[model samples]
Target chain A: MNIIEVRNLCYAYEDDEPALDNVSLDIAAGKTTAVLGGNGAGKSTLFLNLNGVLTPKSGTMFFEGCQVTYGKKEMLELRRKIGIVFQDPDDQLFSASVTKDISFGLMKLGLTREDIQERVDRVVRQTGIGDLVSKPTHALSFGQKKRVAIAGVLVMQPSVIILDEPTAGLDPQGVSEILHLLQEIKDSMGITVIISTHEIDLVPLYCDDVIVLDKGRVVFSGTPAQLFAEPALLRAHNLRLPRINHLMNILHNKDHLAVDTSASTISTARASIKNLVSAKENI
Target chain B: MSGIDKYAYQSKLARVNAGTKLLFTLASMAVCLSFSSVLVSTLTIAVMSAATLILGGCRLRCYIRLLMIPFAFLVTGTITIIVGRISQPTQALVSIPLLGARYGVSADSLKTGVIIFLRAFGAVTCLYFFSLNTPMNSLLSLLRRKTPGLFVELMELCYRFIFVVWEEAGKIHTAQASRLGYDGFMRSLHSMGDLVTNVFLRVFRRVDRVTAALESRGFEGNFELLAEQEESSRLLEGLAIAATMFLIIIGLLERLLT
Candidate 1:
């Protein structure tokens, strides 16, 4: 069953232009979905709508088969269910200390002190930020701050987690650490994960399903392999296919070679290259 | 360096509670203020300088430098004495003219001026040590704990708003820098006014956003002690309190006897 369903959502800013127009999609339960698009492609707008931070002008959001309407009462419930990790850690972690920021969401839910403590401890431990508990938010490194922001959301134990550009503005080590923690959360906890990002290479590695958005519309929604197969469609949307897919497209269309063009990652591309060489020898 | 950043190669005073240090600082100032004699004020400076140096983990040199701030009054007072009363009492055998007037030198006013300088220096040193030892947030937290509920809430809101103002200032500075606002004096003056106006609007918008964020996070506008009880630190704090009291008592008794 679809854990989240959006039907014909439309949103505009100040009557100037549409930010999201007639966009509809479904997110599967306990699966990872990567919403991929170029800049100003309404991916973040869709995320804001999912979290109810922005209300749609003409569409409905359904969480677990129940339609969500924007009201103070419903927003509270929606906030509890949908955890949003903002692109910038500074926006999310405005608290003075790490401990306070981590427990902010849980505190809002009005959980018992013991429950709050337990959740905070668990998330902090999982995020590997136990040593940063006493440190001020400003004193921490960029990676540490990002982890604290994620811990803040994780402590809430939201049913569906939406992270907008989680890996942006991180060093190599910081990016790897975040990706590892994200994999651990999805695999171990089985929470529905929806990440809106422009990292196409990471999308193929981490996401089970890929949603391509363009100009405030859902242009394509399918598996990464299926989407990568259509290079023309990707370019038409002003988005490039993954590097490996780009190479495979060159081999298939230019070289007139019969080879599988579905590989979306570097390692798989190398293997496909080896297979193509062997297939040529057989021919 | 982190171990003794405030004082040169001394133990840390960062662990001490802000409220306790403030109260002891108040007591030091009160003792110093109640006296008029040079000997008593000198003793007051000695005791505070030592306490701040040892217990507050501040350097003696640093406190002395901070004490120099009150010298503006000292400079004015000294000139007043030299012109208004004394003329070369120690250096000159004859009167000197100031503003086309001759003034007589007095020995008693010289002693009074010395006494005034000492008293001012001692009070300023006490305040300096208090600020150096206690962290800013802890000091604010101490204020929040001691003040009335409504006032504490107002102060806390003010502290939170300071960050909002800082962000606004940062953006304004950036915009001005990009526009070459610092090239000329007139532009700089105009930029300052523009910065202030920008800060006001940013702060206005920030208040609504911050309040919403706080409400969403269930901040009921109260300070609860989230820290666990530190038994050893509490004992040390108590000892520090007693030691300050001891210094004030000994100074008072010595002055009375002398």
Candidate 2:
């Protein structure tokens, strides 16, 4: 099922050229979808449009099969169902305290105080930020602030959560930690997760589907395996195959081995290599 | 961390109710300012400083250093009060001839200066004691309850972004220094101009992004924040009230005696 559908989306900032031009894609429900693009590829703009933060110049968006409207009530309802975590945590976090920041969204929902507390507590535990709830947002580290930012959205219990470059500027451990939390969020809540990133390697490991954007257009939309298989197409868009897929390509082309070039993850590549070795032994 | 922020987080009274601290600070400041007797002023300074250092667990050296900030201002102000034109040479305890005028320190002028100086220092100490023990977040939360929502909202944003702007400025300064942007006076001036312009641009962009993020989370025209869990102790409140009464009593007794 499609949680969010963008059809012929076109957006321009002020008098500038279109940031998103005739872009269309369907984000699958209850799955992790990765939006891949380089700088100025309109990933952020698309996320904003989906949440009604920006109205497209000429396009239509459907949330759960209903065409989105620009009415104030309709926009608020859409925002309640769709939350966007900005690329910079500093931009997203307005409250000084972590608990208060997380509670901001719930307050908008007009939930009872007890319900708000319960939701905030659940997200704090889910994000593993129980200790930081009382701490000021300014005191948090970059990684911790990112968690708080995610928690702020997660507390709203949006069915579809969109993140703009969620793992940008994180250390290796921080990236893994955020990805792990996202995975947990997906499995436990079954919420549709959409993230935009240039980290080609993380897409295969974490995302189920891939949407490739280039020059403000949807160049490719498919599963990670299907997307990685077209290495030449990806290269033309200023993107490269994941490290494992690149290695598999080298093995097939230079080493003359029948390796699976479609394998994008380490474990998949390992299995493919084992199969190649066993086939050679049998021959 | 900034100096006040560091102590505020570590202060033993940090967990105390912000209302109690605010009330105590204001009441003490009122007494300190209202009293003209030197004894009441001296007592106010001593009591507030001790409460901050001993009860609030602020370091003595830090408290004394903060006191010196107001002390310097008080000295400059009190100089005029201490020095007077001697109408009677007999009244001059010490006299100096400057620019064909005789400037002298009289016994009466000395007493007035000392009293005013102590009163000003005492009022400042009360404020320092309150700020040192209560974190800005706590104070803001307290204000949110008592003050207008818009005022509190503006204060919250300003407080959070001040740190952001300071950090951005620091990063720009370091980047400039590494590239020898500050090697010469002229270069340093040029670098400063660039830094200011870049910081403003960055902060402007950040504000726009922050607005989008806020909207995504369902922000309407006004900001609604969660109330912090306040720790209120009746025993503490009683002790604070008693202390304020004691200070007031001292001030009254001094007034009666002097």
Candidate 3:
């Protein structure tokens, strides 16, 4: 089931240059989706529209099969259900303490103190930031800050969570840890996850669905396998194939190794290369 | 500022109730201002220094360094009060004549300057005690209950984003320096000017993004701050009360002695 469906969504600034020009896509429920785009490709505008931060000039957004509205109460209710973890944790995290930052959303929800605490505690445990909850936000490392930012949104128990450039500034270990955590979140909680990233290599490993945006339009939307298959089309949109997929293409074409050029992941590439070697070798 | 903030989170007294700490600070400040005696001011400074350095677990070396910052400003202002034009040379403890005008340090003015300087320093220490013990989150959350929502929210956001701006300014400084931006005095000034403007622009843009982020997180007009109730200790309250009473007694005794 599509958790969020946008049809011909359009947004323009005062300059009349479309930020999101006739964009349309569907985010499936309980699955991980990645939105890929270059700078000024309207990825941020789309996310803002989905959260009702920006009112779309045209088209419709449907959440759980109902059309999304921009009315005051509706927008507030919509935002509670479609939380966004911004790219910069510093911008989103206004409270100095990690637990308070997580509780920021829950505080406005009119819940009892005990209820808010329970939700904050659950999210702190889920994000594995139990130790960080007591620490000040400024004292946290960048990766820790990112986790707290995500926990802030997760405390709201949103049906769909959108993360912008989730892995923009993390080390290799931090990056993998965060992605694995996100995957865990999707699997365990059944919350729909949508993230926009410039990191093409990670999309295949972490994301089930791929969305490519270019010039404020949805260039492609499909499974990672299907999207990466069109390397030329993706490059035209200023994105590239995953490193493993690019390697597979080269070994099959330039090196003439007779391996499957379509293999996009390391395991699949390894299998194809092993097949090619085993069949032809006579050492 | 950042160093003090770090010590605040690490303070042993951080676990104490913020409201109690706040009350203690405010009461101490009132005494320091109202007593108007050298003994009272000295007592205020001594008590706050001990509270911050010993009970708060702030290192004495860092505390001394932080004090020097306010000391520098107080010295200059106090010097003006001590050394000024006197109507009568008879009133002068020391006098310097320049340009047919007399400037001197008088006994009465010197006494006044010393008292004012001590009072200011005592109040500064009292505040240092509060800030060095209570983290920004706790302090702001406490203020949320007593202050108007708008002012508290503004202060909360400002406290949160100040570091963000400071960090950005730092990066800009390094980037400019790498290109010989500070090679000379004029160049350094130009680079600093650019840094400020850049930081200002970044702050302007960040305001929009921050509001959007907050709105997406279901933020309405108010932030129902979630803070665990810090059990107010009877002993701590007793200690605070005892300190205030001690200051008042000493202030009265000093007045009697004079």
Top DockQ prediction, candidate number: 2
Cα deviation at A249, candidate 3, in Å, is 2.7
Q: Which docking class does model 1 fall in?
A: incorrect
Q: How many backbone clashes does every candidate have?
A: 0, 0, 0
- Candidate 2 displacement at residue B249 in angstroms: 3.0
Pitting candidate 1 against candidate 2, the one with the higher TM-score is 2
Tens-digit per-residue lDDT, B94-181, candidate 1: 4666776556545566566676777777676667567666644455456655677677555545544455467659877997989899
What is each predicted model's overall lDDT from 0 to 1? 0.72, 0.89, 0.89
lDDT (tens digit, per residue) of candidate 1 on A50-109: 877778899988999999988777887777778877776655666554675676656556
Q: How accurate is candidate 3 locally (lDDT)?
A: 0.89
Candidate achieving higher DockQ, 2 or 3: 2
Query: What is the alpha-carbon interface RMSD for each candidate?
Result: 4.9, 1.1, 1.6
- After TM-score superposition, what is the CA distance of residue B181 in candidate 1 from its true location, in Å? 4.9
Clashes of 3: 0
Q: Which ranges of candidate 2 are over 4 A from the true structure?
A: A278-283, B97-101, B255-258
Candidate ranking under DockQ, highest first, comes to 2, 3, 1
Where is the poorest 10-residue window by lDDT in model 2 chain A?
A: A105-114
lDDT of 2 by residue, B173-247 (tens): 999999999999999999999999999999998989889998898888888877877788676678667777888
